[model samples]
Every structure is written in structure tokens, then in C-alpha cells.
Target: MKKKLVMMLLAACVMVAGCGKTAVSDNFQNSDAKEQEEFQIEVESKIEQEKCFLCGDAEDSLMGYYSKKESIGIVHLNSLYVSETRVRDFDDDGNELFQQGGSSTMVNSFGEGYGSVAIHGNPDRGYTNIDVSVSDKDEVDFELLEDRLCQICLDTLADFYEDQINSGDNENNGCSGYCLIDFQTKELHRLSEPYSGYTMGDYYVKYDIWKEGGGSDWHRISVFIAYLPERVASGN
Candidate 1:
């Protein structure tokens, strides 16, 4: 009975040792795997930072924004007509008085003005009209704004085109280019093209706006823009 008990005890001891060895081995493997994962993440983050630097980080970009005090409008005229008629007012006793008569002018929030000539009393007849409006405050600085907007637009368009190219959709490829307008000069230039070896893309970021229609109408302007090169680059 004593010898049988001794053999059983030794078997139990061997089982406990085997379990301990397995537990230790598993812990080491888990820790090693965690370290490797952390290292990989660090390496990837560094790569991304490098890419950001190459792509002209936010500091080195031009940006644009809609002027807060400005609005835009569009007008369409089909014909030239004018008429002067006394506007009448009627009281309970069929009385008539003269009201001011000239022309009706529509002013948009941006201070743009539109006037249409009364070709006839009929709305169907088209008339020549003048569309004018105060440009956005940003318009005065349009050259700067344009460059920034174009650059950003190019970057975005590039990404969009690349995605489309990958998906095999290249229908509007010509629209991929960027354009900057100098309101003062009334000049429009392509981002890819350089005037005096200074391409707009090199100086400005991109911005986008959503206008309702092509006709002359006041539009809500939304802008996303960047700054001219890095302030650090400018030493300011």
C-alpha cells in the first residue's frame, strides 16, 4: 500500500510541472506578439507623417474662403423692353393716386443688383437686363484666393480622379484640372500652367462652393481653403 501511494504522488508532481511549463511558454509568446504589433504601428505612423510632409502639410498650403459681407447673383434676359405706367391705388371709393414709377431693382445679400427692363406687360416677352453686384470681400483678393483654391482643388481632383481611374470611370477627366481667377486682372489661369514660373498650385490651396444654378441669382457660398505657403516659409 505504501509503495503504491509513492508512485501516485510522483505522477501528480510531473503533471503540475508540465502545466507550469505550458503557462510560461504561452505568456512569453503573447508578450512578444504584443511588442511586435506596437512596433509595426509606430513604423506605419512614421510613414504617414513623412507622406504628409511631402504632400505639403497644412502649413505650406494656400486656402480660400467666401467673404462674409458679400453675395453673388445671376440674371437672364431674353429681350429689351421698357414701359412707364402710373401705378394706381384704389380705396373703398374707387380712388386713384400716383405711386412712384421707375423700375424695380433686386439687391442680393451680397449687394449685387439686378434690373430687368419691362419689354411688355407680359412676362412671356423677354428683355435685356443688367446684372451687377458687389463682389465678395474676398474677390478683392481674388488672385491670392484663386491660387489657394486651385491647389486644393487639384489635390482633391487628383484623389477623385485616381479613385475613378481605379474604378475605370474617366468620363469627366478634363474637369480634373484646377483654375484660379484673379478678380482684379479678370484673368483665369490653370493650376498646371505657370505664369512667370510660379504656378498657382505652388502657392495656394483649394476651395469649393455650391451654387444652385447658372442663372443670375444670389448664392450661398461655402469655402474650404488653405494659406499661402508656410508662414514659416515666409519668415513672418
Candidate 2:
């Protein structure tokens, strides 16, 4: 069952690229520590800028998420929501937590129809990628799927923000370190790492949207999770 979910996510995420790196000439894998560090700094800077755009709904900004050939937008803070789950943190008074397919689900944010969508990420499935071809004929259902995946991604991001506030790592601007998680095939990924900053346990929620005003055009969505850095180090 877990495998099937991951596969579906992978397929949805890839969109046109089909769940693989987007043929980058400067792959981060070959980048050394210094280069990676510099890249991280760049990513962090971009995240802050993008956050500002989201806060004020700046339509002129260019830092948006993407799939193969579609532009994806980060969920505006106003159009985001979260739910709690039974997964206890065990470190903080045994309170329940929100995990993929566990304690939380999506409950509507935008487009006047998407309400309470649920999708799960395999905890064991570290950084993963998927490849599949998508057609425009299913654009209606495509938006629904993209909205749900993005909602999950935003909720995961909200969790990251909460974690930051709890750990005294608070930032007034925006949050970072988020990527999509795919558990189906243990594939090597680079483009999935949207933000170059030092992100912790997070995943990518990808989609393709018409890069137009208000970000309401329908395309596709890709919501994936990144593999832990340690896992990447060991070449898993």
C-alpha cells in the first residue's frame, strides 16, 4: 500500500519531466562543500524574497516552484491550513502530532471547491523522484490533485515553522528547507530540492500552474519529499 501511494505521488510530481532531474548542466551533486554552502545561502535569500511576495501577494515576483514545464506557486499564508494526527512526538508531553496519512489532512484553501484533502508520505521513503507523462485532457482533476498535494506541502511547511519557533530558530521573514518525499523508487534527485537553505525533515509538493496573475491558472502539481542529507551522503 505504501509503495502504491509513493508511486502515485511520484507520477503526479514529475508531470512532464517524468520524475527525474531536469537536465541541469550544473548539478549540485558534484558541488563541493563550499559551493553547496554558497548555494544554500542563495536559496535562503530567495526563500525570504518569495515569502515577501506571498505575504503581500506580489504577482510580479519570479521565484515560483515548478514541475517539468509548469510553474508552481508556494501557497499563500492566507490559503493554508493544517490538522492534527495521532502520531505523538514522544519528546514533548506525548502530545499527538501531524504526520502524512496519520494525524493530518487538507481542508480547503482556494478555488472554491477543494476541501479537506489527504495524502501520505512514506516516513521510511527518503528523497525520491517519479517519472510519468500527463495530458491536458484531465486538467480539472489535475487541479484538484495539485491543490491537495500543495496543501499537504504547506501544512508540512507550517510544521517546519512551528518547529522553528519552538527551537528559538525563529525568523520574521520566511521558512526554508522543504522538498518532496517519494518512497516508491529510491532514485537520486537534485531538482526536487527547491530551497537551497538548510531545511530539515520536509518534502516537496510540486505542480504545474499557468504563470499568470493571482496564480489561478490550471496546469499540474508535484509534491515530493527530500531524502535526509545523511541518506544522500551514504548514497542510498
Give the alpha carbon lDDT tens digit for every residue of 181-213 in model 2.
221121112111122233323334232212224
Provide TM-scores for the models. Answer: 0.17, 0.24
Runs of candidate 1 with Cα error greater than 4 angstroms are 1-66, 69-154, 178-236
Model 1 steric clash total: 24
TM-score for candidate 1, please give it: 0.17
User: What's the distance in Å from true for residue 172, model 1?
Assistant: 2.5
Model 2 misplaced stretches (Cα beyond 4 Å) = 1-76, 82-118, 127-217, 231-236
What lDDT would candidate 1 get against the real structure? 0.25
